[model samples]
Target chain A: MRALCWNGVNDLRVETVADPAILNPKDVILKVRLSTTCGSDLHLIDGLIPTMREGDVLGHEFMGEIVDVGREVTKVKRGDRVVVPSFIACGQCWYCQHDLYSLCDTSHPKPELQEPLLGYPTAGIYAYSHAFGGYAGSHAEYVRVPFADTDCFVVPDGLADEDALFISDAAPTGFMGADFCNIQRGDLVAVWGCGGVGLMAQQGAMILGAERVIAIDQYPERLAKAEAFGAIPLDFTKVDVIDALKELTGGRGPDACIDAVGMEAAGTGLQHAYDRVKQALYMETDRGTALRQAMLAVRKGGTLSILGVYGLMDKFPLGLLMNKGVTVRTAQQHGQAYVPRLLEHALRGELTPAALATHRFSLEDSPTGYHMFKHKEDGCVRAVFAP
Target chain B: MNPVQSDNAIKAAARASVTIGRPADELRTLWLDPGTQSRIWTHFAEVNPLDGRTAEWLARGPAGGEYRWRSEAVEVGPDEIRWSSLDGADVPNTGQLIFRPAPGDRGTELHLEVRFDPPGGVIGEAVSKLFHIVPGEIVRHALYKFRALALTGEIPTTDPQPAARKGGADR
Candidate 1:
C-alpha cells in the first residue's frame, strides 16, 4: 500500500507500507476513497507536535468504504460507505457516554508518554503523533478503524464523497465550536480564520440561529468563500479587525468569538515577531496572534470558543477573561456527538463542505498537495487526495 | 535492642493511584479478573488464578528473563485487596490495592503500593534502571493502565504491530 509518511520536519514521502489489518475485535478496515489535508496537519509537518516517528503515516480527515470488519463489529460491515471521526474513541468510556468523545479515556495507547506533558492523557487520534495514539492514518489505500461499531458512521446515500470527507474533522470541529457558544436568538458570532474549519464554523453559527456571522482572514479567496457562505468577511491585513468588529457590533463586540487558526497563526508587528522568535526557541508552542485578537475582540460577557490546536502560549490574556466574566470553552472536537447532525445538515444543503476541496491529487502526489496547501498556493483551502 | 540493618538493603517500592469513574465493587472485580490483569500488565508472561484468593504469575525481567512468584490474598473485602508473595518466590514482594468511594460520587479512588527486593539488592536495582525498567515507573504505568482498562474497556497502545512495523515495504 502506498501511503504518505512523515520522515522529518518539512519532509514527506510517498512510501510503500504494509497493508492495514483488523488489530482489535471491534476494528474495521476501510478502503480509503478520499483523504484531505487539514491545517492541523501543518502543525505535525512543522515539527510542532511532538512524538512523531519516522515512516509514520500522516492524514486524518477522510472517508471510505469498509472492506473488512472485526468479529465484534456489528453495526457496519463490509462494503459500507463510512466516514470516521478523527479522534479514535472507545464508545463505552465515561467521556464518550457523556458526549465528550475526544476525551475518551481508553483510546490513547501510550498514556505514559503524554501524562507528564499534558498533566493527563487525551484520546488517541489517527496519524497524529505518538503523543496521541500512534494509529495509522487514512492517507493510504486501506486504513484501520478501531472500535468500528462506534467510530465509523455510514455516509448517507445522497451525499457525495467530497462532501463527506470534511465531516470527519473540519465540519465537526466547526460545529463543536458553534455549539460551545450556546448562541441565543439574533446573536452575532465572529470566527477567525477562513480555512475549511473556519468557513464551516461561520456557516454553522448561522445554521444554529446566529443572526450575523463575521469571518476574519487576509486571504481574498477564503474571504470570498466565507462571503459566499453568507458571512461578513473582514480582511485583517487591511483594516484594524478589532476596531472594525467593535464598530460593526455597536461597541459591544461579537457575542461570541471563535479562534479557528491554531498554533501557526500569521500576523504583523512586534508581538508576532516575538512569538515567532520564542516559538523557534522552543519557549512557546503557539503563535497566539489570532487568539489574542479574539480575546480582545469579544464582548465583555461573550464566550470565546477555541477550536484551535495549541500546546503552550507565551502571553495568554486570562486576566481579561476573568475581569470581564467571560466564559471560555475549548476542546478537540467531540465528533461522534455531532457527526449525525452534521450529516443531516449536509443532506439538507444547509452546510456545504464540498466547496473547501479546492485541489485534488493522487495518493502518490500527496507531498505536492501538502506543499501547495502549506504555502496556500493557488488559493488552495484543502487538497483532497484520492487513493 | 534494635536490629542492625544491612548497608545494601534493596527496597524498591512505589505507590500510585488514580480515580476511576466506576464503583469500588466494579473496579475490584475488574482488577481481580485474570484476563483483565494479564491485559493490563502486558509485560507479564502469565497470570494464572490458583484459588479464589491466590494467583501465580511470571513477570518478564530484563534481557528476556522471567521471574516466578505466587501471591496469596492476605486481606480481602469489598473495597480493598492485599496480597504478598509466598516464601518460595524468586524475589520477595508484597502489594496492596485499595478502592474507596471518592467524595461527591465522582468514582472509585484506587490506591496501589508495591514493595520488592531484587535478587542482587542494589546492583539489581541499578541494572533494572539501566534497562529502563524502573520499578516506580512500572507500578505507575500499571496503575494508569488499570484505570484506563477499567474505565475504557481496552488498554491503549502505540506499540507497532506486525502489519505496521514493516517500514516502507510495499505489500
Candidate 2:
C-alpha cells in the first residue's frame, strides 16, 4: 500500500508500506476514496506541534469504501461507502453520551502521554501525534477505523464522494462552531479567515439564520469564495477590520465572532512579526492576529466562538474579554455530533463543500499536493488525494 | 509516618483502579477464569492453571527478559481474590484484586495491588530494574486492558500497524 508519510519537518514522501488490518473486533478497513489536506496538517509538517514521529502517515479528513469489517461490527458492513470523522469515538463513554464525542474516554489507547498536558486525555484522533493515540491515518490505500458501527456514517445515495469528504472534518467543524453561537433571529456573525473551515463557518451562520455574515481575510480567492456564498467580504490587508466591522454594523459589533485561523495564522505588521520571530524560536506556538481581531470586533456580551486550535498565547486580551462579559466556546471538532445533520444538509443541496477541493492528486503525488497546500500555491483551499 | 526506615527495608508496591460498566459479581465471574484473565492481559503475562489452587505464570520483564513463577491462590471471595508465590519462585510477589460496587450505578470499581521486594538490598533494586522485573508496569497494563475488555469487549491497540521507521527501506 502506498501512503504519504512525514519524514521530517517540511519533508514528505510517498512510500510503500504494509497495509493495515483489523486490530480490534469492532474495527473496519476502508479503501480510501478521497483524503484531503487540512490547514491543521501544516502544524505537523512544520514541526510546530512537535509530537509527530518520522514515517507517520499524515491525514485525517477522508471518505472511503469499507472493504473489511471485524467480527463484532454490526450496524456497518463491508462495501458501505462511509464518511468517517477525524476523531475516533467509542460512542459509549460518558462524554460521547453527552454529545462531546471528542472527549470519549475509552478510545485513546495511550492516555499517560497526554495526562500531564491536559490534566486528562481526550479521545484519540487519527494521525495527529502519539500523544493523540498514534492511530494510522487515512492517507493510504487502506486505513483501519475502530468501533466501526459508531464511527462510520454511511454516505447517502446520490451524495457524490467529493460532497461527503468535507463532512468528515471541515463542514461539521464549522457547523459546530456556528452552533456554539446560539444564533438568534436577525443576529449578525463575523467570521475571521476564509479558508475551508472559515468558508464553511460563513455558510453555517447563514443556514442558522444570521441576518448577515462578514468574512475577513487578506486572500482574494478565499474572500471571493466567501462572497460567492453571499457573505459580505472584508480584506484585512486593505481596511481597518475592527473599525470596518463597526461601521458595517452601525457602531455595534457583530453578535458573534468566529476565529477559524489557528496556530499558523498569517498576518502583517509588528505584532505578527513578533509572533513569527517568537514562533521560530519555539517561544510561543500560535500567531494571534485573527483571534485578537475577532475579540476586538465582537460586541459587548457577544459570543466568541473559536473554531481555531491554539496552544498558549502571550497577549490573549483576558482583561478586555472579562470586562465585556464575552462568552467563549472552543473545542476540537466533535464531528460525530454534527455529521448526521451535515450529511442531510449536503443531501438537500444546502451545502456545497466540494468547492473547497481546489486541487487534486494521486496518492503517489501527495507530497507535491501537500507542498502546494502548505504554501497556498495556485490559491488552493484544499488538496484532495485519490488513492 | 515514620521517616527513619532502613534502606531497602520497605517493599515496593503499585496500585491501580478502574471503573467498569458491569456488575461486580459479573466481573468476578470472568476474572476468576485463568484463561479469560490471561487473555485479557496477555501483554503482561500468561497464566496456566496447574491445578485447583496453583498456576504457572510466564511473564516478560520490562527490560525484555523472561521470568517464571508459580502462584498459589491463598484466599477467594465473591468480590475479592488474593494470591501469593509458592516456594522456590524466581520472582516472589503477592497480589490482590478487589471488586466493589461503584457509586450512582456506574458499575463495579476494580482495584489491583501488587507488592514485591528486590532480592539484594539497594544493589538488588538496580539489578531488578536492569533485569526488567517491573511489577508496577505489569499492574498498570493489565488493569487498563481489563477495563477495555470489560467495557468494549476488546482492548484498544495500535499494534502491527504501519509506521515508516526512520532509515527504513521504504523511506
DockQ of every predicted complex: 0.41, 0.44
Q: Candidate 2 at B136: error in angstroms?
A: 6.0
TM-score of each: 0.90, 0.88
CA lDDT, every model vs. true structure = 0.82, 0.82
Looking at model 2 chain A, report the run of 10 residues with the lowest lDDT sum: A265-274
Q: For candidate 2, what is the recovered fraction of reference interface contacts?
A: 0.53
- Strongest candidate by TM-score: 1
lDDT of 2 at A7: 82
lDDT of 1: 0.82
lDDT per residue (tens digit) for residues B51-89 in model 2: 766888876667567767888989989889999998776
Any residue pairs clashing in model 2, and if so which? none
RMSD of each candidate? 4.2, 4.3
lDDT of 1 by residue, A28-91 (tens): 8999999999987886787655577767889999999999998878899899999999999888
Query: For model 1, what is the error of residue A289's alpha carbon versus the real structure, in angstroms, after optimal superposition?
Result: 1.3
